[model samples]
Target: MKKNVLRLFVVGLIWLASCSPLTRVLKNPDINEKYQFALEFYENEDYYRAGLVFEDLLPNMAGKAEAENVQFYYSYCQYYQNQFDLAAYYFKQFYDTYRRSDFAEEALYMHAYSNYKATPDYNLDQSNTTKAIETMQDFMNRFPKSSYFEKAGSIINELRGLLEKKAYSIAKQYHRLRRYQAAVIACDNFQKDFPDSELKEEVSFIKMEAQYEYAKASIYTMKIERYEETMEYYYYLVDRYPNSEYMKMAESYFKNTQRELYDLNP
Candidate 1:
């Protein structure tokens, strides 16, 4: 009974504090009073309320000595509150609204990172991932000399790898279905589109397998010719990956194809 009474008392005090005249004074029309209250809220880590107060003063304080700091802190407030979408929006706004502001570059980078932070799992829609990659690319193009350029480039590479993985996964699905022609074409397209991707080994392996499958599905009368073509693919793999386990498999396949050709022509 005592604990219940204590809880009730605490809840009532919180309600009264929210509705108090002091709350009004802090959020009132006086700029200095509002600014001071915003500072207090920010210091107390009440970011949502602090962001609200700072946003209210931001436009009016533009060109004032405190504008940049206010906007910067306001953006951070949103970030700390886990309001990443709002943080991204405000950070981009700050980047666009301020020229020659000290935090401009950081704001731009954080705008991209904010979107990246909101990226979902790879199985989900990649809309935000694509947006983050584009934004980071834009940042790099705009500020080639900025110290953040390398970091941004690295992020782009990581995002691109995610896209590459998606493509590889879909292509492998086609392979598993015995859609050899489609799988071959998809892997070829992927290599053409993303030549610098880290999935090069996987793509090459898939391509060789797809070609071999196509060859294997041929009629016995045509098998010799088709196997010869498959041998060419295997040879390519051997040349590219001398030490790969796939290379050993390819060499075995090539020798089998050569002996079959000899037997068929004999």
Candidate 2:
């Protein structure tokens, strides 16, 4: 019980020690003194405190020489705190306002990078992912020789991979749900969007299967045309992926489609 009481007292003392300086800096009326303390906090990697001080100083420092550094450091504080959306906004604001500053290029790059960091999972909405790619591409275009160019390219490719995965999963999900027509359309869109995807072979096979199923379920008047479409898909699949793992199933689909078409015509 005594040790516990002593520990609690020590913890309280440590908290007060940490908070005391920040409290003093916060209450100080002198702008230059507060700005200096803010930089000290930032240099010490106490970004939370530094951000608080910077936020307070920002409005008062407008049009002053210190405004630029304050804004730049403020953005960094947000980024270091993992506040990516806010970081992206502030970084972009910094670049737009200080295009001629030496840090402008870095600010723009961080703006793109922050968006990249903000991208959601493959299963989630990818509007932010697309925006990240565009911003990174813009960064590369503006700074061709930038040290960050390779990193930006790599990020773009990674985000594209996520998009490809999402698109493929959606197409495959449609097939699994027995939504054949939607599956066929989604498969076609996926192939068109990611012609170089490693999943192209699987997507083609799914398209063939979907077409076959769709034709089988169609009305008498539409059966012949739909089966004919299935046959066309099957031929395309076999022609492109002659040795595919899905070849056996694909050929079965083809034969079924051919038989159906023959019965309809006869």
Candidate 3:
């Protein structure tokens, strides 16, 4: 009975505290006391309320010593709530406003990283992906010795891979659809754009296959020249990828093409 009474008493006191002046702080207009309350809410991990409180405090706290802390935590409050757009905006704003602050480096990293989080799949629009790479690279250039340098480089590589995947898929799709001319153009463009891609060997095979198909489909007057072009690409593929997975398929093209060329003269 005594324990139950004690629990009831504690609960009532908590309800009164929350319902009274403490709850009214959010509604209060006094700027100084409000800033203190915002800090208190942040310390307690009430990020939603903290964010609202910080928003209110920002206009009042600007040009004051408390402004830096308010701005810093405001960004974090948005971040903790997974509001990445706002987090990115505020984080960049923080660094821009307080470049000498201790939080500057972290703010910049999070700004770029926040956008990275919002980036969609490779097939989607990649403006955010582009932003991430550019911002991370800028961060690296500006802070070459920064501890985040390695992490930034890793992110840039990951974004680049996403771009490569998109380009590879588009070219491969053209090849698959038997649009040989477009396939040749797309594969060539993909190679130029992503010269370092691991898909280079596969792309080489695609170009060879596309050229062979184009020659076979060409008018009689163009067949000989086109076939010769296909053979040239075949030699290049063979020299570069002797043990390639697509070698068997390429060999089939070579045999067929050779028979046609011989029959053309015969």
User: 2 or 3: which has the higher lDDT?
Assistant: 2
lDDT of 1 by residue, 1-266 (tens): 99999999999999999887446745588877788888888999988788888888887786678777788889999899888898899899889988588899999989998887887766667788899899888888878999998889988888877777777877898999999878988898888879887676667878877877776787788777776767776766677777776676666666777787787789
User: What are the C-alpha RMSDs, in order, of all predicted structures?
Assistant: 5.2, 4.0, 6.5
Q: Can you write out model 3's per-residue Cα lDDT over 1-266, one digit (the tens) per residue?
A: 99999999999999888786557887788878898888888999988888988998888886899899999999999998999888999999999999999999999998988888878899888888889888888888878888999999999999999988988888888888999988888888888988878999999999989999999999998998888888988898899899999999999999989998997878
In model 1, the runs with Cα more than 4 Å from the true position are 1-27, 58-67, 177-182, 193-198, 214-232, 251-266
Candidate number with greatest lDDT: 2
What order do you get sorting by lDDT, best first? 2, 3, 1
Error of 1 at 188 (Å): 2.2
Clashing pairs in 1: none
Candidate 2, residues 1-266, lDDT tens digits: the string is 99999999999998898689888898899999999999999999999999999999999997899999999999999999999999999999999999999999999999999999999999999999999999999999999999999999999999999999999999999999999999999999999999999999999999999999999999999999899898899889889989999999998888888888888889
User: Which residue pairs clash in candidate 2?
Assistant: none
Ranking by TM-score: 2, 3, 1
| TM-score for each candidate, following the candidate numbering | 0.71, 0.91, 0.80
Question: Which residue runs does candidate 3 get wrong by more than 4 Å?
Answer: 1-23, 215-228, 258-266
